[model samples]
Target chain A: MSETLQYIGLGIMSVLNGPELFSIFGIGVPVAIVMLMGGLLTGIAVGATPGLAGPMAMAISLPLLISAFGFTPDALLPVFAFLIGIMKGATLGGAVPAILFNLPGTPDAMMTTLDGHPMAQNGQPKRALRIAQLSSVSGDTFSDIVLFVCAPFLAVIVERYLDLPEKTALLILSISFIAAVMGASVGKGLLSVSLGLIAAFIASGSDLSPRLTMGIPALREGFSLTAAVLGVLIVGEILSTLEELWRNKHALKVKDVENRGAIDGLQRGDIRRIVPYIGRGAVVGTMIGALPGVGSTLAATLSYTLARRRHRAITASEDPQFGTGVPEGIAATEAANSAVSGANLIPVLSLGIPGNAAAVFLILAADSIGGFNPGPAVFTFTENEINPQLVTAFGIFTLMALGNLLNWTVGGSFMRAMGVLAKIPAHYLLPVVLLVAMTAIYFQETSMFAIWTTLGFGVFGFFMRKMQVPVLPFVIAYILAGPIERSAREAFSASGADPWFLFKSPISVAFLVLSLAAPVFLSRGGKKPS
Target chain B: MRRINQNMALGAVIVALALFALFAWVPNDTVSGFVESKRGRLSIGDAMAPGIAFGLMALSGLILLLEARKGDMPGALEQRTFAFLLVALTACAVSFGVMIWAGPLAVAVFGGEGDTYRNLRDTAPWKHIGFVLGGTGLVTTLIALVEKRVTSNAVMIGLAAALALVGVFDLAFDNLLLPPNGDQ
Candidate 1:
């Protein structure tokens, strides 16, 4: 415990006393903290826009940041600080458009539009925004606390008990669980994962030689991770969205509703009314966030449903229902979704598995920045030397706490002001975004090969989406491919070439069994017909 | 009642491909098979992981095919989707082509026969030519495709966006180069 406290102190000092951005009164401000503020503001701005979100912003900023800082140990904290700030700030900022414009700034904020829009239309826009801000911060803080408590414990446990084969089995189990839960069917999800694995396999192999290159020289060094990921997640989405907008060109535009200016502060008893919902949402979001690949959308949906059921049972008939402008609804959704940001890092920091798109970017950052590799080994406590990864982890936590502080202080007003972003036309914005994304990738790689790879992946991603394949599973599987193969190879070699090594141990056998059983049970249990 | 589902049909295709990987591609493409023995010790070969992945793909494809009787997969692309993709790809290719060749062509045209584009690739007017023009063209063309017509406002916005990007990537970061410029 004392050691943990010591590491925490070192982490805080590292963040506070790092290379200075500038000095005021002979006191230098740390670069990481300043970047945190910058990222938070940028995140809020982007999240307020209809078509933009946190991950896109992170993806665009990553290459630029890497170029600025290079791949150095000192770069990790500032880079991660900015990314985590974006993750937190975007969660809070998403509620703005949901309330004011009846548009969800982020996908998880779709639930917010139900009650938030009504609250705004009823001349309580600021009240709704304030409630969202408070609830989001409450949930985010709650989950950050959970993350701070849980991640180290989980990582320690994983590191202690999981051997090579068990680790391999655990990875397979994670993939199976993700495949089972995402996409239309388990089959499609597995197919997506397989394709991703194959893609990752191309131009990559054991030290012997490259596999699946098909004689292309460029294939010798596999596709650029950033280009491929951003292509699918950002560029493909842009293409799809633009296509939909073009198809619906003749559709009627939504007329802007006049705002009824009224006193907009939360009235007495409002906090009391929403506290229970917030608590429930935070719990639900944290639990889901701990699981790899289960995202905040599910958390918000589940929490909103549970809150609605309880609200209906207790409230008077005229007090307002879940879908029609209720503070409780906003509280539930904002709390649940915002809570997901911090807890999502649990998987990334503990298992080195990304739970969602935001976490994926964090993993990419770690991979690109070098020096910091997140996994069970990250939490290793050593007596002789300081574990740098542990310090980085705690430094990340400090940055998250700072982000939450910023969210509490200035995030609300900034979010409210960002409602104007929702008015930007997608046609104009998307093309420019595409251009910028391509340019950014080019500047990073300084190779047209990366640009072409991005375009190729973007096309594949577009078709994959059209075919209803889940893109997240593909991406996660792609990232996990290298690690999974390494684990498998090590386990195989360690077991004296035991082909059934995954089944040799009880823990691994259980994990393998669960990997097979998850899709069958989950698909049967949860899959709904389209 | 059992019509072929598009996803299921795609699954069948994937199954065939996976089978090819297992039976043909993996054996031929990889130097060593699933397992290799070197110095009397055993190790997993490069083909092992892909072989496993392809096997999994085959299994999942079979499952998809089996489920085909239940329902059709949603969100299948229409003909117009392909059309849009074609136009988008064409625009990208054209813009890229222009980005690559425009500066060199302009240098050859404006400068005397002795002055080459390679000499002036990093200079002000020459360096900015391809990225700004190609980027603006790409953006403007995409907007036109979406709006079904070209508008001055769209062109202006596209030009402004391209310039801003050049400013951000080039002027701001002296180390960074725009597309084609980096290639050159």
Candidate 2:
């Protein structure tokens, strides 16, 4: 306990003494504020628009930030903050179109339109928007707090027992966790995971001719993480979205609304009604976040499902009011998604394995700029090399907390202001996003290859989405495969070809046992296989 | 589809086995031998023959079986997209062949123009062409720039550029007619 405290103290002191910490706090905090405001405005615009989404916004912003700022840590801070802020705002922003226009800005926000648009037709647009915005802020703030508190505690424990064999076991455990947590069938998930592992293996380097390449000189150095991620997430998603556009060209278009208005203030009754559901959703979201690749969308869907089930069980006497764009639905969805943002960072920070595409990009950015290879060693290495700078972690949490708090305090009114701003045409938005993405990819390595890869991946991502194959496994596997392979090799070297040596260590034995048991436990209470 | 899955699984197992064999039987001393050979002190043929020979044999056995099975698979050419993919694959191979004499940039420009820009317009043809041209030019320029600025050996940058381009293309063409590029 004392040692743990000492480490925490050291972490704090490291932050306090470091010049970079001061610079980060000084520059990052204010820039974060500006970006948050800008993102909030962008989110409202995108959310109010017919076809745009939070992820699209993120993809567009990612490249622009990378191009404008390069891979510097200081540069990443505000961008990440903006991303988080926009995601929060967009959740509510999406409800605008869902209500007034009978269109959802994003797929996950479709549920809101069920009752929201009906309420708008009934002349309760203000009430519906109020409920949605308030519930969203409540959930988002709650989840942010959960992430801020939980991640470091998990990190501390992870740091204590992290070693080569253990790290390898942890990686295997992450793969298993992802497969278990995925909404897809186990067979499909396993296939995707296997493919991801194979992809990573192909991209990995060897002393004599890089692995798996058929004498292609360009492949000798292996694949770049930034390129791979951009390809899989942003590019893939764009392609998929485009395909949807092609297929659904004649789909019913929502009539555009004339006068968009702001959400009214939430009543005490509304707050009281949603408190329990919000708490449950936040907890569920945070837990899902901790698990690799089980991101916010899944978290929100699961939480809503669970909330609905619980509501059904408890309110048997009354007609179950779930999925009615009620406070509970908004609370559950918002909390779950917000919590995931923070929870997704746990594996990335603790194990150096990114849990999602966004986290993977952050890891790559960190690698390129900070020269800090994330893993078990990051804490130890940073403690010794740049201990004074470690305060940035603490500051990040604080800033995240502050950002969420600020968003909550003024978020509803801001949303009200945003309804007016959502009138921007898609033509203007799409080209800007494209330009930003292109520029960011160009800056990543200053190579055209990265840009092409991003575009290509956008298409692939699109297909994968259409095919119902989860992309998270691929991203997670790619990020973790290197460390897992390296750790396994080291463990083998240390144990001198003894297979049982892995089991001989108590730490490794315990981790392996837990890893083996996770699938059974997760599968047991899992929702009836979709 | 089931047969393809089965074959893929079998190929994976064979590759795993081959890797295991290399890890077990191949001597660690070959790393030094390769380094020495590269520095012109000794020929890799003499110094690392055992490792290289064993590795080649194992790799060939795995590849041949996989390829034969892949070739025999039904509906291999049924998809026009798959046919286009094959053409792209052949173009890449030809470009690599050309690279031996023409160097990376010439082959890259030719490959880019032939494979990417020759297709029909789905969205904006000029936009797509611009994307391809800019992408190819960026790769070539980066290799040249990096060679001058960092390493004099443009091979490393060229290789990096090629992998990026191929990765993007592979993602764009989701069909599995062409094997994934070995290096990512």
Candidate 3:
């Protein structure tokens, strides 16, 4: 249609208007492009390492970016561009370690090791790496396009139809789904959510009444979201690492993995063989990503499992199996995991609820840099004024595409450079990271008490991880609690004091039912051992 | 089994939270026995946190109790893992131990105008944040090195790294506030 063409032309123009859109050091530099490249490079390095993942990188980088950019609308695009770059780059970078060293840098890469490592052992490391790159880039591109199409539609529908009570129910449903799928058990997940809600409750500001801060002056100001997240996710992780180091103090053997094996480009036939599996992975990954919290590991596992089953059904059972370095195995995993990078934003942009830890960090970064509020109103169209938020979202999509393009070109070298990245000893890294996290918090809050809060939360987060309670649900709950509270209050008031008002609407009723049932059924069906 | 201990720990935690919701904390600081949120007048939103917290805590506690009846809730978290966690925690705690006394002592000795918290601020005259941070780094490194029974060289490096961290934060980010002299 002409409308589609017109939109495409506009998109092209905006992308080309990069120099005008972005500036750094008062120079007309393409800031989004630079952020995308820098974030991608950082992501690739972090992901290729055995211990670090994309979210960890993003969490550490967030405070630095905030300090640099300050709290401004212009900061959002560059920050997100870098983050999206990391999300995309990490997916591909994870495959490097899994294939070359048989060490999965992240959980999703666990599956990649099955086919990829075997391929490395069988002297097809380059071929396997190439397949992973192509499949990953393909899957990410496919999912980004889906996100570009679907997030707006989903948000528009919610804006048009959903009211306050329905919105509350929808958030409940999201919480239920996230809690159901995240931790070891639904009970544990719910407990984490409750704790998060409690934290939010403690922090909630009141008009006439005193908040539930329990009388301490520091408590009155409440907990900072950045400090909490940095403490819990980044600093807690550092403590955990330190614990590991102390326990393994005598076991400091530097793993000297020979960075041999020249990576060869994928042939047309290799690409042809992988195309179908990549397509399947994209579809599987997209479905999982759009949901609240079943993350990329599940997507990769399911996609690879299905591909294996389908391949077995089609071909002779004895002929080249998935475990035997088949291209399809790599394709399925890489593509599926990669698809999650973009599609994970769906629930985030549409509902303003972060489904997973990575999404939580993204939302935290967005909160730090204001002017873009995620929710149904974000998708609202007005005839008079331009929807800058929606425009920013579109701009983010363009950056993600550029990230994929970067991965395609520089990703091979990234795999080779993994040795240097992974070699940075944890003892050195942890100390510096701890300092940085504390400093960022101190600068932002201008109070050393905030730093203490960060440390306390870090300890608490470590315990939460150790206890097997999922941290993601807790954080998401904490983040969404204020908004949900407002919605619930508004909905209650609007219902003329009807106690059972949430169940009055069919949509609300359906969502409420789904929220209740999801935990029971989904938790029962969970793969984690009891 | 260790998972059994974890279950009990979780149960204990839930019980503690539930009690807090029901009795200890509420929206209002004003009322007696059964009051929820305290208000100057009457407000509808006062009961939201307390009421929600109570209900949700009860439900979660009940569910956790039910799970405790069944056997192993896996994914590590045992007394053995708790030992290592304690070690890391102690190191971190030792590092921050100075922070607790630094502000109060600084005020006592140097005589700051504001409260204890203010004396600890980046701008506080009495506070020497750099030395405090360096001291923390020293304690952390000392703890780790003594535990490992490493040579003096390792101790020196740890001390160097601690001071380096203080220096790096100072130079790289000028406006960044540390314990006191920590920024310098």
For every model shown, what is its TM-score relative to the native structure? 0.97, 0.68, 0.87
lDDT assessment of candidate 2:
0.55
By lDDT: ranked, best first: 1, 3, 2
Q: Where in model 2 is the C-alpha error above 4 Å?
A: A1-29, A39-55, A70-76, A90-95, A99-102, A206-208, A250-252, A256-268, A309-320, A371-389, A417-432, A513-530, B1-184
Question: Which CAPRI quality tier does the interface of model 1 achieve?
Answer: medium
For residues A350-419, write the lDDT of model 1, one tens digit per residue. 9998889999999999999898888999999876799999999989999988899999999988888887
Among these predictions, the greatest DockQ belongs to 1
lDDT of 2 by residue, A177-197 (tens): 775566333433444555556
Give candidate 1 regions above 4 Å deviation. A250-254, A526-530, B1-4
Q: Per-residue lDDT for A38 in model 3?
A: 88
Best by TM-score: 1
Give the distance in Å from residue B171's predicted Cα in candidate 3 to where it truly belongs.
4.2
What TM-score number comes out for model 3? Answer: 0.87
lDDT of 1 at A400: 89
Worst 10 residues of 2 chain A by lDDT: A13-22
Error of 1 at B154 (Å): 1.2
- Give lDDT: candidate 1, residue A129: 94
